[model samples]
Target: MLMAHPAVLRDLVEQYETLSALHAEDGSPESQQRLNDVAYTLCVSTGTRDVDAALIAARHHLPGARVEDDSVLDEEDTPKPPAATSAGAGI
Candidate 1:
């Protein structure tokens, strides 16, 4: 089996955690089961047999890897303030 890219593995791990937290908050039974099925399949189909193993392998392979947080996306969506105009400065 081809080794999974460190970035892809990291994305899956982060997604899984996000889904898990969502499920914990307002999860339905069916949604939980479905999430479990898809999550396990994702782990196995990648290089690792399970989620824990995948996480470990990813960390081992890429020590400096970082999982981007949602705050980055959120901040990008905010509108930037208009630049201040100077009376003497040229446009």
Candidate 2:
């Protein structure tokens, strides 16, 4: 699996958290759309199946991650689903 740059993952995690804090999902259509876009990007970047898992994976890939910290593992320890394709996936 290809891993995203740590800086990029950090930015995505921060962006997603900020949007969530601002209640983007309950805000205007544009805000909700942006949140969804960010969530999807984060998921693809981390090879995770959902937003919650994506956040955890993103943090784990970031700098200073500890081996014993919030470790998540499946039976095979791999991404569960194939990721969706997006032109803006690098975002």
Candidate 3:
């Protein structure tokens, strides 16, 4: 599969994180739209089905990521329930 450059992936992750930190679903439409757009782009770039998986894949592909680090993608790594700031939330 084609992979996005590390720089691009880094930027995408950073952008998504920044937007999420600044806005929620109840925020302005423009911020919400931007968050959704970044999440979609992350999924596409990582060839993953969802933003969470995409984020894992993207982080794994980034520079300095441990190639043998399966832990990052492990189910144990997933956030617990009741959290509201997930990447999939409001997308």
lDDT of 3 by residue, 1-91 (tens): 9999999999999998888888645698988898899999999998988988889989999989876677455587765568566787677
lDDT of 1 by residue, 1-91 (tens): 7756767666666767777778733688777776676577556746667766655655555547455322223476755778887878775
Per-model C-alpha lDDT, please? 0.62, 0.90, 0.87
Rank ordering of all candidates by lDDT, starting from the highest:
2, 3, 1
Separate clash counts for every candidate = 0, 0, 0
> In candidate 2, how many Å is residue 69 off?
2.1
TM-score, candidate number 1: 0.47
Where in model 3 is the C-alpha error above 4 Å? Answer: 72-91
Off by over 4 Å in 2: 75-91
Q: In model 2, which residue pairs have backbone atoms overlapping below 3 Å?
A: none
Question: Lowest lDDT 10-mer window, candidate 1?
Answer: 65-74
Q: Decide which is better by TM-score, 1 or 2.
A: 2
Q: Compared with the true structure, what per-residue lDDT tens digits does model 2 show for residues 6-80?
A: 999999999999999999999999999999999999989988889999998999888899876646776677546
* Predicted model with the maximum TM-score: 2
